[model samples]
Target: MVEQVSVFLENTSGRLAELTRVLGNAGINMHALMVADTSEFGVVRIICDSPSKAKAVLDEAGFGASIANVLAVEVPDRPGGLADLLETLGDEGMNVEYAYCFVRPQGSSAVDVFRVDDERASSVLQAAGFRVLGASELYSS
Candidate 1:
């Protein structure tokens, strides 16, 4: 499982800019991000090089931020790659509550960030021949 930083922000102009500024000032590099919003507020999920540090800085900057454990599964870049992964997980009875994707620097494969209720999903996927990434793999310098 990888640590993801989730921040709550108001749905106003420059809110995202302010959040990014805070993270930037802390020298935290955001590797991936996803935003879900309603009329009044938004939930920003961020995968950074240092999750703990990111959360601390965001809290100090007056942003509501916390860490979540999510699976970073590497899928092939070709067609049907994501579908196949989801199908396998479904067959194994794993439910994906939410997910997001990001391309790795190598470009050979894309990493899918999956929020599953079961922590064992990572080991299960690895045993099923999928490459479940770790913090070092996802945040390598």
Candidate 2:
């Protein structure tokens, strides 16, 4: 299982920089990040090589953080790939709370990481022809 660290941050100056600085100071590497903001706050979802360390750093810095189990699904870097995966998840009765994608390596394609509301992830992967990658597989160097 991949554990994603979701941090609630204020949409103010230096908020994001502070968060990243804390993580960097703690020697935690953020592999990928996605930020969704409203008028007052932002939800920063990050995939780090060391999620526990990242969480500890955020806590020490007085930031509220949460960890969620997500599925790292490798998909082709073409159109309809995401739609197909979402449709499959819908058919399987799995609701996606949020999702983000990162480019795979220089030679590889892309990988979509999804945080599902339900734990029916394995079934979805098997049925959708997607490979479920573990946290180490996705984040570890």
Candidate 3:
């Protein structure tokens, strides 16, 4: 499992930049990010080098921030690699709530973030032959 930082922001100009600026100034590097939104507001989910610190910085800066446990999995950078993982999870009756992908710079693989229905989805994925990364693995990568 990994800690995913989520920042709630208004759907207005400079809000995204402000969020990034705060994290940047605090030296928190984003490993992955995804935004889910409607017309009024957006939820920016991010995996960073320092999740707790990032949450604190965002909160102090008046941004609504929270954290959740998510899974970071490594998939081969090939066709159907991701599909295979999803299929395996499906076979286990696990449903993915949300997901995003990022290429692994130092390896021949891609790292993906996922919000799954089951709390033990990570362990299940690992047992099914997938590489589920720890928070440290993502931060270091």
Candidate 4:
């Protein structure tokens, strides 16, 4: 399990830079991130070493930041791997809300970070033979 920081920012110039600057100044290191934008606003989801500190700085900086639990699963870095995982989840009656992928140079496989409707996603994925990573595992280089 990993704690993701969801930062809600306006869809304006330099907003992403500002957010990064805040985190940088606070000594927070980002492990992975994704940003989605709408006409008026954007949501930046981030995996960081210290989510609590990140959220605190963002909140003091007047950004709407919150924490969410997401499962980081080690998956094969090949086609059909994601499909197999998704099919398994679907068969288990698990609903994946959203997901993203990243690869570490030292790792042999890619990791898929999934936000699911089930709070027991970590256990579910583990029981299904998935390599569910802890926050430390995800952050360690």
Q: Per-residue alpha-carbon lDDT of model 4 for 9-91, expressed as tens digits? A: 88999989999999999888887889978899989999987898899999999889999988889998898888988887898
Instruction: Kindly list the per-residue Cα lDDT of model 3 for residues 37-91, writing each as its tens digit.
Output: 9999899999888898899999999999999998899999999999999998899
Colliding residue pairs in candidate 4: none
Question: lDDT of all predictions, in order shown?
Answer: 0.90, 0.84, 0.89, 0.87
In terms of lDDT, model 4 sits at 0.87
Candidate 1 clashing pairs, residues 3+ apart or interchain: none
TM-score of each prediction: 0.94, 0.91, 0.95, 0.92
Provide C-alpha RMSD values for all models, in order.
Answer: 1.3, 1.6, 1.5, 1.7
User: Order the candidates by lDDT, highest first — what do you get?
Assistant: 1, 3, 4, 2
Model 1 misplacement above 4 A: none
Per-residue lDDT, model 4, residue 102, is 86
Report the lDDT tens digits of candidate 1 across residue range 1-141: 889999989999998999999999889899898998999999999999888989999999899899999999999999999998898889889899999998978778999999999867887888889999888998843
Model 2 alpha-carbon miss at residue 69, Å: 1.1
Model 2 bad stretches (over 4 Å): none
lDDT of 2: 0.84
Question: Highest lDDT, which number?
Answer: 1
Can you give the lDDT of residue 12 in candidate 1?
A: 95
